[model samples]
Target: MSGIILLLQFIAAVIMLPLHILNFLGFWDAIIKKLFPLFYNKLCETYNKSMDEHKRGIFSNISDFSGPSKELRLLEVGCGTGANFKFYPSGCKVTCLDINPNFQKFLSKSQAKNDHLIYERFLLASVDNMTSVADGSMDVVVCTLLACSVPNIPAILKEIQRVLRPGGAFYFIEHVASTDESSWTGFFQKVLNPSWSLIFDRCSLRKTTWKDLENAKFSELNLRHITAPTSVKLIGPHIIGYAVK
Candidate 1:
């Protein structure tokens, strides 16, 4: 079985080599920026529809604002097309952040549609390095489908810990690497990772993001792993939870 899997992976890698070369030549960068928002927004809709129950359970904490004021100050890292805005509770003052500036227009459309929550300024910056946001300023920090792509997961988590208020919560929903190496899914993730990253804005299919969250040492953590209901089998494995700082 192992030998067969390896052979299949090798053949798949060979088939993907040309696309990888195009990615290396920056052929996909401009195209991705132009199309990714639309693609991601559609994916978000599918996930939201399929995983509504799980998402509601995980995001329930955001509604429990124990702050002195009624309004909750929220920051979303990698806030692609503002897909999560609909899930946010009312009276939330949301500040969006993303590496891609192209998403701003789509994000604006999403914001306009979800008018229940207040929209703060959107910052064009990377999640790993958010120097503009002050320490202990955010009441809640949310990230979804982002951990897989970041260049440095630890750095991004560290910055998340830094920006959250003492008791503020960090909520996340991320697809992760399959844990079972003997499984075909895991084998494919390993073999296709290089091309996957090149084509998808450096998003790795093999990151164990849950482990990084565990190592971050949040005061309280509640995490669960599940399979996302998506046709893309490679990205089905996911982790969803929150960590209180």
Candidate 2:
């Protein structure tokens, strides 16, 4: 009986594991954006004390550079299904650009009839070349969880700098590679990265780090590190805080 139960548990984990990786990597956004909101709504609404506390700390750290969003034209590169749309104030004009067709459904679903959200738009494009956005047009550039998977970080940063109005800010939330610890995250990254890339199509955990941000053409920046236990840490090694340009 115990053996049977263990076998069933193992089977379930195997099945769910791929779905989770797909979701985390934003590959499933095509289906997940429309379907998973029912699940994500509950999760984000209820909030986990530990994750929220950490997010709050990290978000607050970024908020210092946010200035005021009320009248700003905000651009979000790689807005996966517009998850952070609900997180931002309604007064700001929010624009999202991503190459994922998956998020299009979510974009349509977010009608924003009664919501406080204002001027929310999604563009399907790459950050490496945002020619559609006029030069020095945006007041703020926000990237959440998307920078980790951005393929052309250097070019994207250049585009960001080109589009952002002088004195505009760049804000991001990303899972950074570890500089301190080498236990759970480093170990799992070394082991699972190959498989993760295979299944997720193109996502790398160990590729992104603070160095990417620091190397970008941004000034007046601050960075902070947020760590977690084995479970979350296995997926997210380090959370980065960036407030620059």
Candidate 3:
């Protein structure tokens, strides 16, 4: 029994040795972050019009939003490379929070390109612990393609709820686990999840995003499932909606 356990441990170590080396070198994370924006930005460029329309529908209901007198205070969690900068209303104050500081350069570029948005501040913090931001301060909180990768979804949602003012909007777009777990794409997602998570800064292939949002502390959740154009089976099915705090 002792020999068998030792042998199993040895095999596991052998299999994980290369992966450990890659992780240590930060090879996969660096490459994916560098290349992901190129393809994803193209997809966003094509689909942004529809997304913008949907976002507008959400904003239309909010009574006290950005106007000539007041600038809406917006917090964007995990604002990777600032892909959604263009979708924001002009002159709204935008605060960006992200775990990885490397994206700061890209964010600066995005801010420069989209002069309409007032880039307020950048916080280097995890989504789950946004203590730097005061409670009930933000009028709007936005997160895109973020839920699938967070370490603790519930904790992050809680933070979001805490920071948002009463009746503030929490806009989110996230990839989620499929209802039919046995489907081809689902199967691939399950198979690739471990490797994918290891490579991409703990981004999970499976997430019950809709259910998670429903279970959150939000007063209202208006979410819709949609098939994203990205052919990647791991993250093809997406949800877009807003929760009222």
- Against the true structure, whose lDDT is highest? 1
Prediction RMSDs, each to the true structure: 2.0, 7.1, 5.5
lDDT of 1 by residue, 87-200 (tens): 899879999999899888889999999999998889999998999999999999999999898878999999999999898999999999998878888978877776677667
TM-score of each: 0.92, 0.72, 0.80
lDDT digits (tens) for residues 185-222 of candidate 3: 77666656666676556778788878889999888888
Which runs in model 2 stand beyond 4 Å of their true positions?
1-50, 54-70, 110-114, 228-230
Instruction: Estimate candidate 1's alpha-carbon lDDT, on a 0 to 1 scale.
Output: 0.87
Report lDDT per candidate.
0.87, 0.63, 0.78
Give the runs in model 1 whose Cα sits over 4 Å from its true position: 1-10
Q: lDDT tens digits, residues 137-205, model 2?
A: 887887766665667777878888898877787776666666644565565565555445444445666
Q: Predictions ranked by lDDT, top down? A: 1, 3, 2
On TM-score, the stronger of 1 and 3 is: 1
* Candidate 2 global CA lDDT score: 0.63
User: How well does model 3 score by local distance difference test?
Assistant: 0.78
Which of 1 and 2 is ahead in lDDT?
A: 1
Candidate 2 local Cα displacement, residue 182, angstroms: 3.5
**Candidate 2 Cα deviation (angstroms), residue 213:** 1.3
Cα displacement (Å) at residue 67, model 3: 9.0
